[model samples]
Target: MHADPRDARSVIEQDAMTWRQMLIVLLCVLLNGLDGFDVLSISFASPGIAAEWGVDRAALGIILSIELVGMALGSIALGWAADRVGRVPIMIGSLLVMAAGMSAAALSTGVVMLACIRLVTGIGIGGMLACNNAVVAEVSSLKYRAGAVALMAAGYPFGAIVGGSIASSLLVEGTWRDIFWLGAGMTIAFLPAIILLVPESPEIILRRNSPDRALAKINRTMKRLGHAALDTVVPIARDETGDSSGLFRGAMRRITTLLVIAYFFHMLMFYFVLKWIPKIVVDLGYEPASAGSVLVWANIGGVTGSLLFSYLTTRLPLRGLLIGVFAFSFLALVWFGMNATGLGELKTAAALVGFFANAGVVGLYALVAASYPAHLRAGGTGLVIGLGRGGAAAGPAVAGFLFVGGFGLPLVALMMGVGSLVAAGAIFVLRSPPKAPVRP
Candidate 1:
């Protein structure tokens, strides 16, 4: 009897993962890590850029916010486009955009020019994130999907660490322009590997094309993935009666809304820590270099947290895991706020906050990937992420306002702590989706 290829998830679930599949996941992780470098490179180079441009901290803040706006736009638009087009093409195109933008940014003479370039770069980073998350999830077996996504999530912090180290060393001998140039060059270097190794999602081809075309595409992908060719392709059974609005309809509407709320509040707290933790450390009497090191430690914690989350998903329900993570994040923030003062205490607090917050966000990505159907996965993921960028953008600004409004560090910490609690509550109320079957 011929094997049924109707359900893409079933095909992946039935096959034991091979080196080819592992390579696809690794490629995605590397791409996302590069994106992390690109996204946070501005932060690493900002002091040098500001000094050269004669701009103050406020001006630099504007520069940061503009890129977030571009990211929000890119995540929504390109993410939806990935569904209609394909993930690989979108991923490649976005990388090109990032390279061009970073290269242009290196030559920018004025703040306005640099801001525009950063916006373009942000668009590329944001678009890549949504597509990458969906593609990684699609290609992995159910048994390993969470682990794969968690590994991919670690790429961001890994990139940040790599970018931060390079920028720190290069800044002693070079200019901010040198940093952007290096980032651009590094991104371009990955193009060949991506084009050679990554295949378009088999699910996308089968969902969007005619049977003849789908069969050919499926066989091509299978061969690339080191699997035998299939005799034929059958489309996954799905109700076509619903409106094309995708994730916003029926049960998905509730799920989408809850995810958006959770993402927004979680990001609000997350960006707050990421953007301000160093400054907070400095205010507590640490040297600038020491403060920076603390931030790096936090990112290291993020990597650890992501890997832990991957392992934990195997042992716990998604909803409970996320809720617990967010709850712990809130407590960590409160602890950091109320008691962290000495060097050791500050470092420990930062790591704890980073661990829980970053893990919570990655958990959300995994949950979103598993909840949506293959056809709508990228778009749904994109929409939620795009909306969440609003919170990410607002986070730092709100924190700044709180500082200006005479809120002490403790108070500011409490406010962010509240955001985490709200996020936890959102997850707490969310109804978990029914478990999908894993075919042997």
Candidate 2:
């Protein structure tokens, strides 16, 4: 039987998931994994950069956060582009920019040059992340969407785990430049994978393309996914489908604002942990290789937490579960600050912090996916993440200044942990989001 072209979203929501859909989700995971490694590559390499250049902690903090500034720009700009052009196209373009940026970073002669390259790399990573979230959500069955998104979110820590392990080994026998080289090669390798495998979102095609163009594209996607093709296509009006401009409309404006605030606070805490763990370990008198290992342990904990959260979503209410995760995350960060004295203690505490922090991250990913309407999904996610990155950028830089200013680790830890608590409070204030309007 011929299917209603407009019901394509319903098919994705109600029917059994096909391998094509699963492949798309898996690719999203890998892309997110790339984001993980690229973001932390500097973290893994920071000690060497500081040592080689004789840069102070305050300077180093700026270097650590400069890319996040670029990320903010990329997320807002590329995210809006993803909504306008297409998810796959923006993603493919992001990979190219990332590869080039990483390659340039490997050849940098000065701190200024490297920071500039890293900023460029952040632009690619930011755009890629915004697109990946939207693609995974749009393609999954409703029953499995949260789990799938959680799994995709898990890729961040998983990439950190794998990349950290390799980077630790590299640090033993190679200079920090080797790390960027590896990242560049990996980013280049994914270019072909995306081109050959991934497709544009049907919902996006319907909203943005002309009726004839939308029908052909949607049918091609449907055919690949093993679904029946439709004889006619009714293109969704731009106004009917909603857009980024609508994000601030009466009720949605409140949800968008609160969600962005929550994300901003949580990201501030999360990046503080991820960015500083390696440096913190190095300061404790361990070798850089060992420092990388400690960071790896954190990512290991992150993966564990993300997967567990994915499982729990199937059996529990997401809103309550998310708030609970944030509560524990705040405690874990404070505990890590206070009790991680010895190497063994440091590893254990890092893992605990990672567990809660990353789990909360997965929950936030799911929340963003569910909260926005279909058309605004990518843009909304990008807006939240882009602005939230202000916190991510601030976390490391703020901690650095605090360290320079004579604040103890415990006090700084307590201060950063407040981000998660504030995030939880924001989530609590937000009521159930209004459902998206149905297309005629």
Candidate 3:
């Protein structure tokens, strides 16, 4: 039988996911993992950077956060662009930009140059994050959507686990620049894979092309995916180039607002642990390599938690599940602050914090992926992440300032832990979007 293009979405919903589909999801995971490593590369190298430059916590905080600022802008800009132009283009371009920025970072001579380079790298990452989530959502079967996104989100920690292990080994014999070089090499390596393996999402084509044009394009995609073709095409109500303001329209306005709030607060909790763990361990008189090892323990916990959370997503209500995860995240983080004294204690504490903190992140990504309609998916995700990254950027920087101001670890951790609790409260009020197939 000739492939029918019109029912492509229904095929994705009702049928078993094909290897091609699974490959697309896996690609998203690998891309996200690379992004994970690039973002954390700074954390792993921070000790060496500080030692070589004689930088203080206050300055380092700004350095740590500047890339996140770029990420915010990139998520907003590139995410919108992805919806307009296509996800594949934004993703491919973001990879090249990331490679360039990482390469530049390797050659940076001063704090200013490194911060600027890292910020550029972050712009690439932000675009990738927004686009990758949308791709995973559009490609997966309804039965697999939640678990797939959870697994994709898990890649961040998986990348960190792999990258941190390598960084730990490298820092012993190499300088901080080597880390950026490694990131650059890895970033370049993904460019060809993305170009060859990923096709533009069918929904995006339908949105951007006229009914006749859309049918031709979508049929091409359907053929590529080995799905049946549709006899006719129906365009969605939105314009070819979707409006960003649509995110604030009617019921969507409230959903977007709540998602942004929840994400912002949770990121505060998440990045605080991720960005500070290595430096915190180093400050405790551990070698930089040992500090990196502590962070590996954290990502190991993150991988485990993310995988476990993905499993639970199939059985539980997403909203309730996220709230529960956030609550546990708060308790775990505070525990880490109050009790992490010895090396073993620090490793254990970091692991616990990573488990719950990253689980909360995976849940949020699942919610975001399921929250908006096809036309608005990437844009909505971008706006949420773009603004929420303020908290991500602030988490470490705020902790840095607090430490510089003489606040103890326990007090600072308590303050940071509140972000997750507040996030849980926000989730309590948020209703799942009517369009989402998952249980509310």
Candidate 4:
């Protein structure tokens, strides 16, 4: 009996998540957490780095934004590459790049050198995010897909929380260089796990190989995932032009466009808070150590918010849920700006702001993962995220300009609040297409 090549989703949907599947998701989460540390480490160390280098706010803003520029480029370039190459190779290679860049960043003599190194590091991060999101979506059952992505997204802020705590403690005796070294060390340590435990997406194997080869790969994966072997693996019909180009053609064009716009605004607000909060805390009279701790509290809120959003995904439509999250974020940002005068109030406000803001952003990740088919998943996600990095790049730099121009905290908060409102509106207009089975 000739078995038509089956969509990978059918295999995944039929099987309950076994240990192997769970482990894959867990590893992805851990990797993403490390990414959080690497990406946000500069924020934690910015105060010390600036003071040591005598870098002004505007210059420091450039330093902060440069990595995002690289991330934007990396996401598009590497993410598109992952559709053709395998996700695992790109992910592991990205980890190595991040490790090298972070270590080199520790030795930089001037801001320019550090900025260039950070750009390289951001590329790895961008590539890793695209791969990680695609892997999690492809590997998990549909029932658990949103939750897995949310959990993976939470790893970032969790890493930020951990990194902040470490940075706070190290600031007592160590310089900012010490923090970068630590990030590098942590990134290097996670590499072996990816090699040993994480498997390539089975869907990718199907798309890239001959039918016989694809069947063998899928059966092997199925056995490992604790599922029965198929008699035949059927391939889905696809455009012959290529998987990556399919993102902009036909129905995908609108979905891709709206996702980019929503993510762009979401990232703008999210990164503004992530990159600048520590400095803002210091400006409010907190010491560097105290600022780290405050940021930790904010990330704690981020973790909680991700988990909360994960729960909500089960009950609400993705667009409606996101709209509510962005709306709540706007209110929270406004409140935090106005009411966060005392230290206690500031911490509380930071937590609330992080909760709403981070959740909104991660929800977009889940939405993108769910919206696209397997063939274009990584590239589509990467393109949206890469384009979104424009907002991420702009957010801190614009904030820096405002800071230098004598903009007050309340005004800055109002600007971010406006971004949140815009993000909400963008997602509200986004129309999701029918879910496609996992196939190239």
Candidate 5:
């Protein structure tokens, strides 16, 4: 029987997400989950942690915000380093540090000890995110890139949900230390998989030596993926030829700054909402359990929105798509704050806000990938995403401070909408850097 060429093509495309690919995503997602567990668990466990340590409420917020400081710094620094050195080393090192941070948190005796550990953990999360954001975007085909990035983005909420669930289980039976131990344990789980399977960037391979080995590896991967007809894996160095260094030349500098700003605003609102929503609900006279449930629904909405929008981005003008989504997000936030005071309305809006906000996030990632050429893809990705991490890192800190000032949820959502609008404006100003004509 003769095989269909289309079938083979399908296999090759799907092979981009083969089990090996899935594991890379899964491990990174798990690392995200580990980060989520620690961050979310802190909020859920704060009362207990504060009580046990005899710390004041003000100090606890600082303790929780500590890791974010490290994360923001690590994200920018390590992301830059990945562009200079390589992704794998930075990622692996970050994972190891994350594990240590968790271990430290597990054994922390006072507020100071916990805060120190949280900072370490934040740094580790930052490093891992910076590298992974670049690697995952560059590794996949353009066809599935948005979906892959969005799916990864969804991991945080899922992880938070998992953390919350675990918190419920442990609230009576165990201490907050148990949550840290589990989070750390998960970090260790991914180390072996990451070391073995995550390949070096193909672009890096091409520039380091003759293209032969790189092409050979591509051929080998293709063959394993059941494709033998791929005559060339290297495109004729079109679209701003040569390496991460090339980003500093021509229009790249201006564009790079825009990307950095875009990412920062995108993360600002996203991280703020993610870290604080449950707390906000609790403050609104709901029980901890009820608040957790609302947050869980929002997270579910976020995952759904990410999946839906990611799929949609491949077919639409991705940048414009983000603008529209965020506009909808602004509208949703207004409605959520106004009409959602009742139980039913609040629940409905919780899901919508989660979906729209995360969907907007997915669109931001797609835009990041499309903004630059392949040579400096990782660095360009890192530069923008690292800037975003600044906001993500600052999110908890800012939100915690704002909550203390007696701000309501309405104002919080509106403020984040401002961040979304800023992102939309920056994206509007961008023109896709020159593209080569496709052969028909």
Candidate 6:
């Protein structure tokens, strides 16, 4: 039998990245940057915020965990919702919630109030990231989608740089509230653009009860871009067929397992170092400013991984590249944690770890994304992240426990390094379906 036209067209659309695709990637990346910046800012200003509110550090840690809690909930709940309710509405709602939480943070006088507001901010961060990343992955043409996701990811680090720079300057003359105000301000600017520019994911719409409406959305997306000169159009694949229960699908189980394992190990290493390294550097006798600079180098390493791996992803198999990158990261962390004698060695190791680890994590998302056909992409995306978020949520807390228990840097590093190895093994079991085309 001839293949359905709608299915063919929809698949084609999700598979490639056009100019419009780039715009989506850019917006998602910038929004993600805003998210990343907020996460970093809290760390930078934690002491100041604690002092101003006269709260214990434990209270501040709660405030910090608030967003992560929201993200774990967001990825699972909102990802399910995105597949059901739609991508654009959830994305827009995320920004609004983020704005509310951030504004509340700027206005708070006590730790309880700050944590409450931060809970709202966490919801926004979780929802936006879970939904948008899925949307970006689902809407792109197959050839460029992986790299596009990577390119969009570049926004995250840039936002961190922006937030850090603003914090550094404001700390000299202002309070931590100024940092929240800055975040609220940045998110607000993007809010309007998202409303005007972002359309719903064609894949999600296609899976709905109304194929006619889904096709209309496709035409609208094509018309909005002024490029309707196509010989083929992707059609809606399912109303009930295939699978929507992202994690339960047979095709997804292994991919989901692999992606989550990778995300966990990567986040464990990422957060452990990010949370403690400044203090670690200080313990080694560096000045406070110099200690913070080690992270700066590490963040740069993450950026390098994001960019470089995005390139390699297009040229190489996703699983192979992730394995190699994680292996490299594992070795780098063990070396850095065990034998880094000074600032120079630490910086080198930190960057190398960041490069491989961060990219490996993103590559997992892209890989899981590809395993699902159009109908399940959003659900699959969310489930993978929900698992990752679980790991992420626990990573820092685990690190704190280890640190309080007097675990040495090498011991913690060994745990994360071994985690990476486990993740690499998990990827070996993952396989895309017989029907789905291998990513180019």
lDDT of each: 0.77, 0.85, 0.85, 0.82, 0.67, 0.68
Query: What is the lDDT for 50 in model 1?
Result: 55
> Which tens-of-lDDT digit does each residue in 1-440 have in candidate 4?
24334555587865578888899899899888888888888998899888888988888888888899988987888887887788889999999999999999999999999999999999999889878877887788867776787788899899899888998899888888999999999999988888877766676787788878887787767776666677776674664324678888998898898888888887888888888878888878788888888788889999999898877766777778888999999888888889757778888998999999988987787777677876577667778889988999988888899889998888888887788888888777777632221221
Model 4 clash count equals 5
In candidate 2, position 348 carries an lDDT of: 93
Off by over 4 Å in 6: 1-21, 50-63, 110-112, 204-218, 229-235, 239-242, 249-255, 278-292, 314-317, 338-346, 429-440
Which clashing pairs does model 4 show? 4-234, 5-233, 5-234, 5-235, 6-234
Q: Point out the worst 10-residue segment of candidate 1 by lDDT.
A: 431-440
Per-prediction count of colliding residue pairs? 0, 0, 8, 5, 4, 13
In candidate 2, residue 329 scores what lDDT? 89
The count of residue-pair clashes in candidate 2 stands at 0
- Candidate 1 lDDT over 1-440, as tens digits, reads 34454444467766788798899999889888898778777766665665678765456656766677778888988887886689889889998999999999888999999988888888888888878887787778877876687788899988877776776677667777887898999999988987898888876796689878888788778777777777677665665322348788898888889888889888888877777765566567655455556667777888899888877776777778888899999888888888766877887887888899889887888777677775566566778889988888777668777776788888888897788788888877777553321111
Q: How accurate is candidate 2 locally (lDDT)?
A: 0.85
Q: What are the per-residue Cα lDDT tens digits for candidate 3 across 1-440?
A: 67454465677666788888899899899998999999999999999999999999989988888898888988999988887799999998999999999899888889998988888889999998888887888788878877787788889999999998999999999988899999999989988888877878877887777777887787777666656777876666545344668899999898899989999999998998888888898998899999999999999999999898878876778788888999999999899998868999989999999999998887887787678776566567778889999999999899999999999888889999999999999888887543322521
Clashes by residue pair, model 5: 67-118, 70-123, 71-122, 71-123
Give the poorly placed runs of model 5, Cα more than 4 Å off. Answer: 1-19, 22-32, 50-61, 83-85, 134-146, 205-250, 285-287, 338-347, 431-440
TM-scores, one per candidate: 0.88, 0.93, 0.93, 0.91, 0.79, 0.83
Residue 112, candidate 4: C-alpha displacement in angstroms:
0.3
Q: Is candidate 1 or candidate 6 better by lDDT?
A: 1
Query: After best superposition, candidate 1 residue 11: deviation in angstroms?
Result: 3.9
Model 3 spans with C-alpha error above 4 angstroms: 228-231, 237-246, 249-252, 369-377, 431-440
The superposed Cα distance between candidate 6 and the true structure at residue 333, in angstroms, equals: 2.6
Indicate the worst ten consecutive residues by lDDT in candidate 3. Answer: 431-440
